[model samples]
Target: MSNVIFTSSATAKNGRDGHVKSDDGLIDLKLVNPANNQVAKGSNPEQLFAAAYSACFDGALNLVASQQHKKIDSETNAEVSFCKDPEDDGFKIAVTLNIEIQGVNPEDAQQLAEDAHQACPYSKATRGNIDVKLNPKAV
Candidate 1:
């Protein structure tokens, strides 16, 4: 890490059915696996990842548009899925980012989304490690 911008940390107790709290005390919640048929009192890892990825991708979209000297209104929704890995008999995750960009044509919106994906930190981190699908639409 060059010239560290900022770092955030959190602690998780127990695997899927425990508690998690952030160092800033902003996130303190119970964890529950939605697949276990339990009422979710807090949230699962997938939800957290989705939240982070969506926000990051949206920011990346704006940044890319700004660099191109274009103004665009964009929304990014990340769908993270936990699935069984057929290759390893383990579990893996995948992501689908549905992006909506206003004030641009469909092709341009998609180009913006693709450019954003190339710029997003989350997308860079998950590249080649997980399957990511991008769906961009103009609205």
Candidate 2:
């Protein structure tokens, strides 16, 4: 196992429609409710989670490409949806990762995405916990 190289902490006042800020002060934003998922409005936990996951997955993709001696230039976006869980009245989340890769064919892009998902920390955490869909669109 690898040792922890970094750590981050954040606190939220209200569950959905409050405020959250990291200890480092780098991220300070108001949390909004997920009723509409409006990008222009204040962000919610789902959006923050999506941002972190996408960045991590993109880094993993780049690392995979380097490890495989393959060149890849890509943009990845994660769309997270909040839904009610079937098991209970509580809520759950689903994810769809849309990857746009430049200078690669569709097959190669898909392979790279799959490899990244296998290696990404976010994917590993959500593997059995939630639904994640991977879509690779090459350009």
Candidate 3:
């Protein structure tokens, strides 16, 4: 079996501004200098995390649904909140999944959501336990 590998490289300049090189090429992200933000011109860590979480959860849900023979339409959306831990001086993230899966029952959606939460790579990789709540819309 052939495996497809994805690689991305990023370099930070002037503290926060950096360029990320992917399969396509270089993309720039410059911080606002004294803005106390990690992303100068593009987006900060929180934004990036949100994007990843949303996409990953969606992909995982798709896989679960397909495996379960659950038919679904519509899309998946996630909102991630990043906050500092008062005791550890670290950060934590909470993700809320808003899933629109037409033609699928709420019970099936809940099961799939749980499976997706366990399967998503982003959920696996985070240092702190990622909290996920699923909101399934009526089909």
Candidate 4:
């Protein structure tokens, strides 16, 4: 905890059907449950998670490439899915990060992605709790 460099805080009212706002007041949005047949006026938790994960993964990819002394043009798309947990009859989430690196071979790109997955904070946090699949391709 002492080595923490940054922290983010947000408050959510109600369960998936109220409002969420960051401490900085930069993100204030209405929340909706996509499975409830509700018209989404703002955003959902899955969408928010996807955005955060994709951005974080992209940054991790850049850091890995820089460490390897390789110039990479990369894009990361995170797809987060909320589904029923068959084992416990509860709910669980899964992520698939579709990554593309320009001017790199498929194998190299995949390797970079694997390395980045080990480096990304999000990936590390969800390593054993949730399933994450990495799909990297050269573009």
Candidate 5:
């Protein structure tokens, strides 16, 4: 078998009490409870998923655009929602991606978005289990 590895470490601060450490024990990360706060701080599963999905989608879009020789300058936003499954008490996620790319035709932008959605790692991982919506706009 082949092996690939990375490391993450976390410490409790004002947000969450406990921290998580990776195998190699390098990078630090934490999970915080956003109970009274409006936004989630520290690190949580949803935040991690959101970060992963957003970055993956953006990378996928960039790959598609580069392959098609298109120039796009804008932002991509991904919102990932996680909730407990009522039946099994498991977690489920829902993602909504909004992409704004300037100087590209709407059709081409849409095509790139389609390709990105197909290529995104998080989308591929959560296929058929969660709801993922992609909205691409040309600005």
Candidate 6:
């Protein structure tokens, strides 16, 4: 385990139909309202999670590449789907990640993509809890 570095705090009001704001007020936004199992207004949790995970994964990839003394400009995209599960009688999430790392061989890029998933905090946190598919589209 690593030493504690920093912690973040954010608050959400009125559940999924009101507002959410970070403690620093940098991420203040209205929550989305779901009608007929679809978003009717504003942003939703899945969107937020997707954005965070994609950016975090890219950062982790860059970090790992740099640690290997290599430079890469890459894009990692995360597609998150939130759906209701009949068996669990609750909501569940599925994620698909496509990572493209530049300036590397395809095999090396795939290796980096796999390594990045292991190093990414979001990936680590969500492991075994959700369905996640990682596809490296490196060229």
lDDT over C-alpha atoms for residue 99 of model 6: 89
What lDDT does each candidate get? 0.93, 0.91, 0.68, 0.93, 0.75, 0.88
What tens digits encode model 5's per-residue C-alpha lDDT throughout 1-139? 3364743454444544346555556646766755435565566656766776788789888888888898887578888776678879886777889998887989988988998888876778788988889899988
TM agreement with the true structure for every prediction: 0.96, 0.92, 0.72, 0.96, 0.73, 0.90
The weakest ten consecutive residues by lDDT in model 5 span 7-16
Give the 10-residue window scoring lowest on summed lDDT in candidate 6: 32-41
Cα-based RMSD of candidate 3:
3.9
Model 4 lDDT, full chain set? 0.93
Clash list (residue pairs), candidate 5: 9-27, 9-28, 9-29, 10-29
RMSD, candidate 5, Å: 4.1
Better of 3 and 4 by TM-score: 4
Q: Give all candidate RMSDs, comma-separated.
A: 0.9, 2.2, 3.9, 1.0, 4.1, 2.0
lDDT of model 1 at position 102? 91
Q: Candidate 3: where are CA atoms >4 Å away?
A: 1-4, 14-23, 32-41
34-94, model 6: which lDDT tens digit per residue? 5433636688788889999999999999999999988889998899997788877998889
Candidates 2 and 6, the one with greater TM-score: 2
What's the C-alpha lDDT at position 3 in model 1? 94
Q: Model 2: per-residue lDDT, tens digit, 1-139? A: 5799988999999878789999999888987785855554688888999999999999999999899888889899999999999899899999999999887889989999999999999999889999999999889
Off by over 4 Å in 4: none
Residues 1-116, candidate 3: write the lDDT tens digits.
34758656665555435534334444455444224654345655555657677888788888888888877765778777776777699977677778777777778777777787
TM-score sort, best first: 1, 4, 2, 6, 5, 3
Worst 10 residues of 1 by lDDT: 33-42
